[model samples]
Target: MNKKIAASLASIVALSTLAAACGTPADTGTKTGGDATQAPAQKVKLTVWHNYSGDDLRAKAVRGQIDKFKAAHPEVELDAQAIPPDGYRQRLKTVAAANEMPDVFFTNSGSMIKEFYDGGLIQSIMPLLNKQTEWKNNFTPGAFDPLSFNNEVYAVPVNASVTSLFFYNKTLFEQNGVKVPKTWDELLAAVKTFKDKGITPISLGNKAAWLAQSSILSSLANRVTGTDWFLKAVKQDGAKFTDPEFVQALGLMKGLADAGAFQQGFNSLDNTQMEQYFISGKAAMMIDGAWALTNMAATGTKEQLDQIDVTVLPSVPGGKGDPNTISGGAGGGFAVSKKPTGKQLDAALELIYTISGPDGMKAVAEANQIVNYKMDVDQSKVTSLFYKAYNLTKSVTFTPVYDAYLSSQGAEAINNGLQELLMGGKPEDIAKKLQDAQAKSIGK
Candidate 1:
């Protein structure tokens, strides 16, 4: 893998060195430096929505950039809302049907943004990128691929996300005399050990259906199906989701549930709440993406933060995929509404640049998240558990993030099916559902 691919948001953006690069107190990126655009005449009222309400530096990083834009453009009336992650997509969809998407909003690439673009509710960001030549040049090439449609960039990538990480508390592991699991069976045994000790083995919240698929099943499934099988499955080529390999991958998730690895009522919980269960010692481990690392560093107490470390899912028997690969890719980003034009368009463009541009990427990088930008951070002062997490990403390969690869209908079918799996639904049933939905999606 290339250095940029190896350096995911996982731990490549080490918190301590980032702290040094960002200042000990952390550069909030809220500084209203200088205007990137001319001051607006009439108050440019732009309603913006995003899913950065997590209790982490990632959220602060997003808001800080928004605050900076607000500060610099005093004449612009910017109404920014930090919506909950679980609800933002549905809420945005509802508004989009009414042609009421926020002038600026956080949006994931692929089908999510494509829906908006197809409806003429979204606008391309390439024009502004073309103007800021240096800023455009800094991003890792293909960073904008997911958001591009027929070469028109509808959005910009905000994170280089490795969608799944097996985060464990070292203190909990030591206390229970359990070492990190290296194989699937060992992982199951560790779950039994923790559960017997009256601790939740894993903290999971599937209230948002996507978490089970994107954060857990994506990476876990990859270990069984392998990248080659997966590529065929997505394209409905030689393999299908219902094939034995993919079925086995789905069974592993069911296996975790059967082992009682997750906390009670996990499906009823939200992802943000799940972090607290692990952070506060109620759970021994949490399976999440890179965002959880940012949350732990930003909110957990220093001592508790020190106890946390991350790893990839354990190897499964007869698995076809590389044990070192995790499910992830560049996904989350922001897009503009087609409603804006003239000065409003200029202000909206500036807003997008401010949030995902060079300065903006640096802000998020320091906030404990990684971006597609090739940064100039000094790694010499790194001294935290965060650095270890970065090393993990550097060593592994990233599998496809399902949402970024699957058809919208196929992605939804699997996401909802995962929720069903946690509730004791059949693995083969879910696999068959996905296979049918995806095959029909591609007319294959």
Candidate 2:
């Protein structure tokens, strides 16, 4: 079955089970236990939807937090439902259209937040944020940029993600006697060294399409022309992708692809297959997000994990850009629906506060050490390489990728264009198409 269909069906089953047990209408208020002489205060049930099905560990961690919230707030019953990550957005859309949205839900901070905000289905969190001093101080500058629309915050960021680096196999590099590259020229030379040593320099699984565009070009563009220019290009304000910087970046990507930097049949391999290639030493490097390290650690041996190292892509020679500029965003966050009542809202806010506060923030960061939250965690718990990547990101200027900054429609177009480009579409054609689509989207 399609992943989206399966998730939607699972959501239906969950909703049905809840309905059967409660025997209450969707909007019916819960009756609290109080004095019979006095009218009982109306109790509200808040539904929360999340997609955290990657592994039992993540699921258990999240459930533990939810259980803690439930034990503290008895009046506001929380109907927490976990959906498959692949089809979560589709299921959320279906729920919204049916007017059965949960009081609070999990969503990405970029175009997804904008869609919910424009539809008036979600509430603006700016007021709540402004009223809370501790919450405001918990985040770093640009941390809320993804959840902001027209200068109003609509969501609270719980975690941060960046596509600034890819993990490489140090053993492979050392065996091949190739030093890690710090410039585009050195990168090309290292690729040749790996090739001469009969090793695949890059393990890129383009079967998923977005992985290539999101994890590679997004960061490369930042390294090529700085974040401001890239953002301007995406926004169609005064920049174009056909300009020297973007064209050069695209050309470099093409050069690498043509030079056999990636493994054979890369376009046919899925993400898991590509990871296996790297883990088993068939490939030397893999372009992926920071989460890649955690996933590998969860399933690989300590020695295997120790062999991996993360670093930002090298700068282009003679390019007017800095190596310290990074491509990233606020990642996933929490948002509440506008239809929830005061008590339910209070409970949801409390839950959000707990999960995104200092303690929870530190836990999440320790789990995925690449996270950019301003929470402090014990350094002993994280790998040295993870700390290296985290500190590198901190010292850089980060910018959200196109999908995290563009409108929903525009983001889809960019994804499609990227796929086309990877499949041999001309760079000029892709640039022209993206620029035209962006202009049309912003006009509407």
- Clash statistics: count for each candidate: 1, 0
Instruction: Write down the TM-score of every candidate.
Output: 0.85, 0.83
Give the alpha carbon lDDT tens digit for every residue of 1-444 in model 2: 999989987896687557757875554334445643232343467888888656533344555677778888867767888887657888998998898888888888777777788888988766577777786776887778778778877777666767657678899888878898888888889888888888898887767556777788887866777777877876777887668778777777877876779887777776667777887788888877666655565566767777888777787777666776666767777788998667667777777776666666766667654554666656687666667677777777765576677665666666677667766677777776666777788882
lDDT of 2: 0.73
In angstroms, give how far residue 203 of model 2 lies from its true place. Answer: 1.9
Q: Judged by lDDT against the true structure, how good is candidate 1?
A: 0.83
Question: Cα deviation in Å at residue 269, candidate 2?
Answer: 4.0
Residue pairs clashing in model 1 are 11-390
Best by lDDT: 1
Please give the TM-score that candidate 1 achieves against the real structure. 0.85
Residue pairs whose backbone atoms clash in candidate 2? none
